[model samples]
Target: HMTVISAREELVAFYERRGYRRTGVLTPFPYDDERFGLPQRPGLAFELLIKPLV
Candidate 1:
């Protein structure tokens, strides 16, 4: 399992190419916290991605 910033469509596609699929889980990005990053806009979040093994 991994997380990708929802805004980064390219990354999502990259991961998708690697067999990772969106879990439809959204986590609120830590705004105002440098630990995550400085959000230039509101409503940003981390989207969960998962890859299943055979």
Candidate 2:
């Protein structure tokens, strides 16, 4: 299983082309949490991606 940000459409597409699929799981960006850093913009979120190696 893998996860990626939906913000990066190109990256998501690249992974999808390589056999990855969206898991429909979305995680909101940590706006309040400073662990990652302050978001430059609002409404930022991450989308979950998955792939099976079997």
Candidate 3:
């Protein structure tokens, strides 16, 4: 299991090319948390991706 920023299409495509698929799960970006960095725009989220090793 892995998660990547949904906003990063290139990164998602990279993983997809390597056999990863979206799990349709999303996690909102932590805009309220300074540790995660402040959002300069809205609608940021993480998309869950998964691949079976079998």
Candidate 4:
């Protein structure tokens, strides 16, 4: 499983078309942590995506 930024719907769709599906799980962006740089906008989150092998 991997995560993509919630705001990037186009990327999500691109993965989905290749067999990846949404996990319906959302993770909050590390706003307090600057190791990942700063967000361009507010309310940024990550949506989990997975490709089941089983």
Candidate 5:
């Protein structure tokens, strides 16, 4: 159960301020393969932020 957010890095800090913790997981996105998606770009990677309910 999770939601993925993708966009310009300018919003990185914005999310962090809201209590989203930066995750250690990152992956190089395959720009040419349809396995990922239709749109592709250079230096594109996935960043994860998680918040857990206690």
Candidate 6:
């Protein structure tokens, strides 16, 4: 299982403290076209985070 958050570096660090690690960033994102008729915002991307359950 994995969780990811597309946010600032500080936010990623915050998740890191909670056992989440920075795997990578999401490659393809439809930032140009509006999905669901929603407005577009900058830095609105996806990041990959993973945490191992033990």
Off-target runs (Cα >4 Å) in candidate 1 are none
Q: Between the candidate structures 1 and 2, which one is better when assessed by TM-score?
A: 1
Tens digits of per-residue lDDT, candidate 4, 24-54, equal 8999999999897988999999999999997
When 2 and 5 are scored with TM-score, the better candidate is 2
Work out the TM-score per prediction: 0.88, 0.79, 0.88, 0.89, 0.57, 0.56
Candidate 6's TM-score reads: 0.56
Residue pairs in candidate 4 whose N, alpha carbon or C atoms collide under 3 angstroms: none
Candidate 2 whole-model C-alpha lDDT, 0 to 1: 0.86
Per-residue alpha-carbon lDDT of model 5 for 1-54, expressed as tens digits?
A: 122434555676677677777775776666878877776446776667787666
Error of 5 at 45 (Å): 0.5
* lDDT string, candidate 1, 1-54, tens digits: 999898999999999999999998999998868987677888889999999997
After best superposition, candidate 1 residue 21: deviation in angstroms?
0.3
RMSD of 5: 3.3
The total of clashing pairs for model 4 equals 0
TM-score of 1: 0.88
- TM-score of candidate 2 on Cα atoms, chains taken together: 0.79
lDDT of each: 0.92, 0.86, 0.93, 0.93, 0.63, 0.66
Top candidate (TM-score): 4
**Model 4, residue 33: C-alpha shift (Å):** 1.2
Rank candidates by lDDT, best first.
3, 4, 1, 2, 6, 5
For candidate 1, the lDDT comes to 0.92
Q: Write the per-residue lDDT of candidate 6 for residues 1-54, one digit (tens) a residue.
A: 344446567888888899888877574455666662453555556688888887
